[model samples]
Target: MSRALALVFTASFGAMWSFYLLLSVVPRYATSHGAGGIGAGGMTGALMGATVAAELAVPRLVGRFGYRSVLAVGLVLLGLPALALRAATSLPAIAGICVIRGMGLAVLFVAGSALVPAIAPPARRAAALGVYGLVVGVPAVIALPLGLWLAERVGYAIVFVLAGGAALGGLAALPGVPTRTRAHAGAEAGRGVVAALRSPALAWPSAVFSLSAMAAGAVVTFLPLAVARGSGGLAASALFAQAASTAGARWWAGHHGDRHGSAGLLLPAVLLAAVGLSALTLVGRPIAVVLGMLVLGAGFGVAQNASLALMFEHAPPRDYDAVSAVWNIAYDTGLALGGAGFGVLAARTGYPAAFGVAGALVAAALVPAWRDRAWLRPVPDAPHCPRGYR
Candidate 1:
């Protein structure tokens, strides 16, 4: 990797560490401090809602302020708020802090994702993104489970402090990264969110990806509580399995899609996610829970890489920011909806049954995925670019 890409990856590592370390812990924190499932889920919803809100504006921010300034501000916003979380006991206070952190996460993701393809060669674009996915995934694999383990032993305050410090520490890498790339320097760059949303080429892949993202959101937010009590170790192990598989699958998918065309993978990816979610309906079985998460993670990983690669193939370099914005919006909005909506649904239906319903909902996305596949199919005799080229 080049120096600039490595720096971006380094910054991303810290940001994701901070975000994932507290992802499940914060919601559990809300519940422990006199809140119900809805409150816990609302914490996630508030965070992701703020993320989507910021995603809508991040391209403009990057355009105006350039990447270095925006990224530095993002790290500060993400890290500083968690330092106060140790003292904030009320649900409202916790939710408020999450909102600020979410905005910071938005800037980090939007700017970083846009920069990857801009920095790398087009032929290797998906592979570069695969490396990026692996970088981000490592934090989720380690910190997601470790936070809960640490909270159980050392207490939430320590975890919160660690989370805050991780993000703040990423500031050291900024000097190596450029303020803006040539792709982002033009006046016409980063202004196509609405236009991208309007076009079917972008919309179909986004819709397919959103389905898996919603399932992932629900899994990460509520999986610990969904399993039988005293299964904290099981929850941690299961999450580790999920994150590990996701990282591996994302890398494999990127390379495979680059060679074979990403469109063909979307249908199978959605179906795999549906099957995995359905298995979660049997929460009493430990083997089933672990296996289910593994499968779900694989599907989620493939969908994540394939959909993103396909979208970038459809658009030019100048629209990378807008494309990243649209993709991130779909992802975060799906998370918010799943976190909040599943809490309400789970409250009434119970967790196992709720998993079944969620599976069915994911399966409903197959129609769109199939449509996207048909639309994105490449002509057989056309000059070969990448497999995903029109």
Candidate 2:
């Protein structure tokens, strides 16, 4: 990979690691502070809502401030929440920190994603995105388990400090990247969100992204609780297994998307996710849960990379900010909806029924993939391109 691409990946890895670490510890911290399941779930939901709000604003922010400046600000903002969490002794205070942290996550994701496409050559864009996803997945895979372990050994405060340090590390890497300024940067500056909705090509991939995100949200919010029940207690082994499966699957799927066109992989990835959800519904056995988690993780990783690549490839270069906003809105909306809706559903029915409903929703994602497969054809060449032109 090129040096620019490497830097993007490195920065993304650190940022995402910090985000995941906080996510892993938030529930434990909440419970320790006397919050229950509903309260914990609400905090997670609030975080997603905050991210959506930030995503809605990112296009304008990127236009006004530029990507590099936006990213730097985002990294610093991410650090603040960690410090806030360390001092938070009440549910409202913790929720407020989550909201702040969510805003930082929103900015980082949008700026970083938009930056990747600008820095990468068009011909290799998909591959570059795949590599980027792989890098993000690496730290994500370990962040949760490690965070949980550290929290258990040292305490949640220490985990928050470590996560803050990671955010600082990511911020330190940002200055090394060269800034890209678009030609129509002014005209394109405030148009990303609207343009994304108007373009069916961009919207379709986002739909797929949203559905997959929903499945992931379910797992993240409830899998630990489920495991605790199944094991008769919360064991480190279960947490480690879940984190490993998620991270490992993401890394592998990113490579798969890089090798094959995203369209070729979309349906199968969605189907695999559905199957994983189905497995969880059918059998609550520990080994089965682990296996299902692996399937779900792989599907999520591949689908996310593929969908993002598809959106970027179809989007006009000038619309990067808008496109990034659209992608994040879809993803966070899915997460928020899934966490809140599934929590209600699980309460009304049970974990098995909740898993089944989630599986069904994921299965529905394949319909659009099948129908829109041809819509994602490779970009046509300019009239006077090279000899390999078809």
Give all TM-scores, in the order shown.
0.96, 0.89
Report how far off residue 231 is in candidate 2 (Å): 4.2
Per-residue alpha-carbon lDDT of candidate 1 for residues 1-390, written as tens digits (9 for 90 to 100)? 899999999999999999999999999999999989888899999999999999988888888898999999999999999999999999899999999999999999889999998898777888888898899999989999999889888899999999999999999999898888988766775556888788676788788888888888898899988988899998898889888888888888888877787777776887888888889999889999999999998998898888888788777787888889889888898888889889998999999999999999889867755644664655444332354453
lDDT digits (tens) for residues 1-390 of candidate 2: 667667777777778888878774786688788976666667778888899999888878777666678888788888867876888999999989889988988998887888777777665666566666667666666786677678777888788988887886887677776555553444534455875788777787787778877877777766666564445234344445545555555555445544555556666766777778767774457777777777877777777777776676666777777887888888888877776677778877788888987798789866866776665664545321111222
Q: What TM-score, to 2 decimals, does candidate 2 have?
A: 0.89
Cα displacement (Å) at residue 85, model 2: 0.8
Kindly give the number of clashing pairs for every candidate.
0, 1
Query: Which portions of model 2 show Cα errors greater than 4 Å?
Result: 182-190, 229-260, 365-374, 377-390
Error of 2 at 308 (Å): 1.0
Worst 10 residues of 1 by lDDT: 379-388
